[model samples]
Target: MAALFLTLLLLSSAAQSAERTLVFAAASMKDAVEAMARAYRERTGNPVVVSVASSGALARQIEAGAPADLFIAANPDWMDYLEDRKLIDVESRTNIAGNTLVVVTGDGAIAPPVDPEPLLRSGRFAMGDPAHVPAGVYTAQALDQLGLWEDLRPMAAFGENVRVAMALAARGDVAFAIVYGSDAELSEDVAVAYIFPPETHAPIVYPAALTANAHEDARDFYAFLRAQAADGALGPYGFTKPAAGSGS
Candidate 1:
């Protein structure tokens, strides 16, 4: 009986060790990543833990000694940041998905060639803070290209992340918001006021990679996400799958 109990304890310990993996991803990746985690869990009987926030914040957290095994960044820049710090496994990095930037209105009708002066005079607009959030970075790029950044600068309400900016727009607390196209799909309360031209700013690409300290299981999960991108499983969540033969 004593021998059997010891064996059982060892088995439990191995199982626990096999189950440990931590994934840090962008806020925009919330629903889709959760669904992918569920599918992986069902298939492998191993659970994936996810922490969702701004890509920059997650990168900083990882740099600060956070135990993240995998990271999915909203853009290449944050991944580049981690790479520059030598925190990521260079060969494991891959382009997982893409997104579009748009302006959404919580209430009232607003359209293309958005006249920022009138809207700013009436109500505040929401944007993720350009300092560390990719959505805001894209928004700033687009607005500046459109020649509206200077006029609309002071009327913007900055949020910690893109989802929060979308929420503010959804609640009608902000007249409009700049967020991912996928975000507009999440909230019925808001509508796309305008789809910014892709050329207006740098392409919004989601790049993913494993941390240098990642466990073996993390490699499997990282591969799973890339396969999902290939399988088009992430399409419903508003992610653009890697094109065929693009070698994602």
Candidate 2:
């Protein structure tokens, strides 16, 4: 009888110890979030399961009951979508990081252009699909500000996400791509051709929050992500700290 009791206790303990948090994050945040998840696991002995995709897709998945505990979006619109639907804990929403757009090209395949229009007009350039991808939306905003969106629309090759768009540039399928600055730093096959000025579009922000039905471990992990440890991990991956007063 004692042996049976001991076995059951051990099984229960193991089950409790195995609890993990599920995080849905934007594709662009893959590196930084994975690094932070590793650090969190080491520090707390709790595992974090990460799912990466475009913010729009992730949001729809969450809405369809994907069972994500936490969500990190590359832009506020997706977070707002959930918040408006009461799918996320509004009080927990906070902007955690910032990013900027850059033009990238296959290494040694194209020269950086001083005037972006000529290169964009000369050959197809890759961009995220502005209909849903935040990176593409930002790229569209910047191009519009430069008065190039309409004229260059016909030459644009749209990708489902920033990584897809960047890959097209890296593969030399397109002359250049507009993607997050952090993405350009990650690949040896690609090089930054130009950086859009900050004023060219709205500031890029990464907002993180717990889902409305998040478990205790999710809340703990969410707190850890808002602390200094996460901030340290993000910087190495080209993510900038959010400016003071940045909102979700």
Candidate 3:
């Protein structure tokens, strides 16, 4: 009886300690989400597990059945990809934030009207894979909008994610990278060369949603972010509040 009681107590302790919410967020939101996780734990004692990566990669992971509690994508398209497959709770989905694109260099600010073609000819320009990564998708669209796509294609160095692309510039492997305004602040080595006009491509938006099988606590964490954003929790990290009618 004593041995059985001890075993039961251990199991109970394990179960209590195992309660955590898993969130898959876009790479660009890493700093903000990490900050939120710390605050959430202090307030509710419910730990949050945040996985950061490119929206495309995170969506693919979800499609392949990774056990994600929440999905906060850097763009709506990836969240749409999951929602179409019934992987997400559509009613819970909302645009949580917004960002803009920028071109930056590690060594110094490159003057704008930012003619990228000649710059690309002499140096490899970094971006997330324009085919899949949201930042890259936006970059490509903007380049096309500016008539720079066809000419600059050959000089592209694609990273699997936005941060990876920025790292190329951060590490001096590439001098320039087109990245989110939020993410550029992460690398001391890179400086903003040009801010892409919002009209250059589709507006950058971040949408968050619960998985269809999300933990009940997942909803709580989601709500906390919304509340805190209103209270300025997101401001320090360069996140902008979602505009009205843009909440998805």
Model 3 regions more than 4 Å off:
1-18, 110-122
Q: Give lDDT: candidate 3, residue 43.
A: 87
TM-score of each prediction = 0.91, 0.93, 0.90
Which scores better on TM-score, 1 or 3?
1
Q: Which candidate is the best by lDDT?
A: 2
At residue 80, candidate 3 shows an lDDT of 94
> How does model 3 fare in lDDT?
0.86
Error of 2 at 80 (Å): 0.4
Q: Sort the candidates on TM-score, descending order.
A: 2, 1, 3
Cα lDDT tens digits for candidate 1, 159-218:
999999999988888888899988887677888878888888887888889999999898
The 0-to-1 C-alpha lDDT of every candidate, in the order given, reads 0.87, 0.88, 0.86
Per-residue lDDT of 113 in model 2: 71
Clash number for model 1? 0
Considering lDDT, which of the candidate structures 2 and 3 is the better prediction for this target?
2
Regions of candidate 2 where Cα sits further than 4 Å from its true position: 109-113, 229-231
Error of 1 at 112 (Å): 5.3
Checking candidate 2 for backbone clashes, the offending pairs are none
The per-prediction tally of clashing pairs is: 0, 0, 0
